[model samples]
Target: MKIISNKGGKELKLSFRKVLGVAFIIAALICIYFAFLQQEKYIQGNAEYKKIKQTATDTPSDDSKHTQDFQVDWNTLKTQNPDIVGWIRMDPSVNYPIVQTKNNSYYLKHGFGKSYNINGCIFMHADNKSDWSDPNTIVYGHNMINGSMFGNNKLYKSKSYTEAHPYFYVYTPSGKMTYTIFDVMTVNDATVPYTIDMQTKEDFQSYLDTIKKLSTYQMNVPVTTDDHIVTLSTCTNHGRQRFLIQGVLTNIENNNRVGGGD
Candidate 1:
């Protein structure tokens, strides 16, 4: 009887081990499947974006004065969704159409086409001017795990990355403008970067100095009240804190300009 009981206990232990092993295999497979699905979704999204971009570029515009001008097909995009404001492109990652509404929440779960997507469209703060004319235009996007949207935004935390990729471009109906990154920092979501009420030059400069001082990397770029600034804000590890990539409008190529070559 003792021998039989010991044999039964040994068999039970083996069975339990087998069950755990199967469970682990199943969990791993599920994780891989979801990862693949996310990857496919990203690829499909990029393809759609490229298609729209190509069509926009191919369509001729009557304004041939600025031969090197690159303008989004705002007319067509607006027809599909009137909230389409502009497009932003940054190397090594971020390139997407910017959208806006009366409030900031809608695009957090919707794409440029207004389709529901976990990787929400990049959008500007509701209070910001759609023409990128605000003193401090703020844009927000998700820090997706798959490195889509602003997933790679945290790359700016490294000084080397900031030095290598110092500039990004924002395109509006008026023209294309380049912004040189001046500071990148992680701060509370309610910090000064979110403030747009700096009416005085001194006030704005003070705000700028505060952010510049908070930067992890030091930069010599000059920022002035005359310059239009864009702030790209995304989530950091902390729930209430955000990572900000702040840039100053360095150059503008108005569609009306006539004598420049790229």
Candidate 2:
């Protein structure tokens, strides 16, 4: 009886050890699975951080700065067109998709319909100033969330903001251009003029007058008939309002300017 009891005890102990070992293996696998999941989240967060490093033009949101080292070699990536000269940098992160394109979103890779409105870019020939390719260009961008997309709407309340960050540079495959920000305005289409005639001297003057009246800050910019104007617009007030920021092209030839956009 004693021998039989000893044998049974040994068997029971061995069974318990086997059970314990199996449980440990299962627990370890669960832990490894969770660790992998956490790594994926970390990767996504890092991508977001780098993507938005330069969303703000003036101040550093956290510790990162908004300027990018300019390289004209990237101009080869730009679609070929005289009217669609080059891309402008507002901050290194946000490259205002430069183009003379009214039909598409300035050769932008994503955003537009993918992240913004589907009707990305369309030609607008405002009356006097120039065509959609006019020296002074007025184009609208869709309102996007993350605020970094085309959240140009944020400019309306930023009178002090624009003053602090007053200029951005343009880099073309062929030449570089400089621009000084002069006006930031918010308006609803008071006159439903066609987009083609939007730049007509008469229309442009009215447009100028309207913007000046709505300007939150005083602008000392001298925009002659010769200067090129580029306006970036986006939705505001839940798409009820539009925000406009205007700048005159300095036509800086010989690459005399330092460009990273902001």
Candidate 3:
């Protein structure tokens, strides 16, 4: 009887331990599912929020509604961002502002929250060139979310997409400017000419040569040492390559009424 009692007690304890283990496993699975759901919700919310905020800007409103006071034509891009030269507009346009960041921290900092794409995202330099004034300004963004960021970057690869959307409207903070898309290139990240070698005439010339050699755009712009430019960089090929589109400052003369083109 004693032996039987001991054996039964041992069996009961083992069964209890097994039940607790199963409960733990079930709880862990539930937590993982909720985490996934939350992440999806966050991304969706971010896309939606940006759209809504842009509606407020798109609607005609008082001049004071703008971040700056320089715009006469409310629709003008110059009035939008004093530092912004032009914006990238897409087919399935987000109906919102293409976000601008002042640092790489936006993604890591959750500046865009769930809307942020870790695969590719926007980054900026506080003192780097602005689209309007600099002969060559560099604005960096990413492509991921299965190429949504730079994935559509491949859109430029299509000759038809290039022909259909030949002109990308650029509005500089200095004033509204137009950038005739003249160059597109997929380059190694090591060729970091845009970020470096801006200090001297020699450096700038080398930078220009590198781009000219690699440009996929058939048409060419007359870029002089005096000319300012804009460089849009995004990650491609899983961060191994950089998809870059460069634009020259063209016809800046049309943007004077807003006191731009400085």
Candidate with the greatest lDDT versus the true structure: 1
In order, what lDDT does every prediction score? 0.78, 0.52, 0.53
The TM-scores of all predictions, comma-separated, are 0.83, 0.55, 0.60
How do the residues 6-105 of candidate 2 rate in per-residue lDDT, one tens digit apiece? 8888999999999999999999999999988766644543344234223311223432243434444332233223344455556323454344444444
The superposed Cα distance between candidate 3 and the true structure at residue 58, in angstroms, equals 1.3
For model 1, give the 10-residue run with minimal summed lDDT: 58-67
C-alpha root-mean-square deviation, each candidate:
4.5, 11.8, 8.1
Ten-residue region with minimum lDDT total, candidate 2: 110-119
Per-residue lDDT tens digits for candidate 3, residues 8-84, read 88999999999999999999999999988767755764565354335423332332122223333324333443323
Candidate 2 regions exceeding 4 Å error are 1-68, 74-85, 91-93, 99-135, 152-156, 189-206, 256-262
The candidate with the higher lDDT, 1 or 3, is 1
| Model 1, TM vs. native | 0.83
Which sequence of candidate numbers ranks them by lDDT, best first?
A: 1, 3, 2
- Sorting all predicted structures by TM-score, with the top scorer first, yields 1, 3, 2
Q: Summarize candidate 1's per-residue lDDT along 140-181 as a digit string, tens digits.
A: 999987787899888888888888788877777777788889
Per-residue error for 107 in candidate 3, Å, reads 4.6
